[model samples]
Target: MTNLPKIGKPATNALNTINITTLEQVAQLDEHNLAKLHGMGPKAIGILKEALLEQGLSFSQLDEDLKNVKFTVLGDLKCDNAPKRRIIRDIVIASIVGDEKCLTEWLTDDLV
Candidate 1:
């Protein structure tokens, strides 16, 4: 399990009690569910949200929303949006090289 952000003992204990020791695990829960955890306050939640974003991750609902967006690779392999283009390029490279682990981490099973 990866170390979570320093959200204080009470909030950390609240996450630990539910076996959420990794930011990936934290990403699985929506804000509503996280807010329901005893000892998890809004400040702690804000900290966790920032931590998750630093890793290019977000709550499950956001991931679900992203999955709804269709992706395509153009013939020229060029894009005006640097970040989105980089993401697309990375996925394409990962697919071409058969980087299953990278693909699995970035995509849902259905998308994979």
Candidate 2:
């Protein structure tokens, strides 16, 4: 089931144009960007806001530098152990904060 709220057809189409079909995806976009969409008027934005709040989620607070950042793993994950899980989580947090050193710390000689 889709988590996207019942915003009007025009507003829904606007979000779909950018591939935002889920509430989680919507949460990743800020108000400024959403407002810029042709069909996203104030009423639609408000409805989305309320829907998100009901689900205990809100739009991203991304600043200019962090707004378009993308993170990906090119290969299959090698392990599902706790330590590796923590390392992966740390790397994501470090990347968001621009901590290059923390990102590099996980890439030691033993890493496979």
Which candidate should be chosen as best, given TM-score against the real structure? 2
Residue lDDT tens for model 2, 11-36: 99988877778888788788876887
Clashing pairs in 1: none
| Model 2: per-residue Cα lDDT at residue 34 | 81
Model 2 misplacement above 4 A = 64-112
Highest lDDT against the true fold, candidate:
2
Error of 2 at 58 (Å): 0.3
* TM-score of every candidate relative to the true structure: 0.53, 0.55
Each model's Cα RMSD: 14.2, 8.0
Per-residue CA lDDT of candidate 1, range 19-103, in tens?
7789998987777667767899999999999999998888767345333334422223444568766766777868765799877
